[model samples]
Target: MSHSTNLSHHSRRIDLDAPLHRKAGPMTHAMQPVESAGEAQTSQACPTPRYLTNSEAAAFLRLSPRTLEKQRVIGGGPRFHKFGRRVMYAVTDLEAWAGERSFETTFDPEYIDRHPGVQRDDQ
Candidate 1:
């Protein structure tokens, strides 16, 4: 089998049976061609937001949907938005909330600040 490739305004035929050789050069975004103006406008006209449902958000965060519902009612959970009567979670908000809980150690200063009742040997 053979394949035709167009590079630098020149068409070349490649023999698939031949052994492939690596070329040392800077990587380029040639594989991803630039979007045309019409395509860009169409995308802009119907932009899709990254919103997840309660169950999907829970799955993404590795938690139970019931836990998220409880948090929504009580407190302590990622930020969420309500669309009419539906609850929605944005990926960015989830990431930010998870980022806030990140700690280098169990006794991290920020963690201690968030949980003042937590006793630390250094205290």
Candidate 2:
């Protein structure tokens, strides 16, 4: 089976049968905005909520879903909400949680104060 792929910036088509690495130049394609009827209807019905699921929140923070689950069980996780038995994380809460952990260095005195459970190597 052969497939035709369009190259960006150049008016040339590459065949799938050819060696991809050799024929396919820079893999950069500009994305075009698309609007569908469903999207319009949904927007008109209600504004989208800035909430993410456990997996999505984990991905946004570059953490594993298991880690988030553990944090939820133990402590020190971002603020979450329960909407009809569904756990959701707000974008603002995630941002605030991440912001709180920011420090200039590991040995910063504030780090020890914020995380009292942590043990410093020096100590």
Candidate 3:
């Protein structure tokens, strides 16, 4: 099969739990600004801090929020701070944490053989 077919097949199998929310198209005429009163009430609903929230941190790591909390208790996650009862993570620290976990592979001939079509490509 062609490379494009292979890429399309691979892309179709993607399964991500946390997907980014997006609008389908450009704004329509029906889109109206809410009144200031409604805006004030909406803003009051669970105030998220200027810093990264637990959900944001989890999204950054591509993990569930509970998993992040578990890592925090076990000292396995990036360093964070508590602002009162709420836990906050630094964007820079999370980036550093991701970088530290990155790994480089040392390809082996046997390993290549285990992957379909890889051996054919090699030789």
The model with the greatest TM-score is 2
Candidate 1, position 99, lDDT: 83
lDDT of 1: 0.77
C-alpha RMSD by candidate, in order? 10.8, 9.5, 18.8
* lDDT of each residue in 1-123, candidate 1, tens digit only: 778675778667787534353233322242222454687788689877678899878877879999999999899999999999999998789989988898998678888888867865557
Residue 100's lDDT within candidate 3 is: 67
Candidate 1's error at 44, in angstroms? 10
- Segments in model 2 whose C-alpha atoms lie over 4 Å from true places: 1-49, 115-120
The stretch of ten residues in a row with the least summed lDDT in candidate 1 is 24-33
* Per-residue lDDT of candidate 3, residues 1-123 (tens digit): 565434544555534422333333322223322234566687689565335788877776778999889989887788888989999997778878878665445266544544557766768
lDDT of 2 at 59: 75
Residue pair clashes in candidate 3: none
Ranking by lDDT: 1, 2, 3
Instruction: lDDT winner between 1 and 3, please give it.
Output: 1
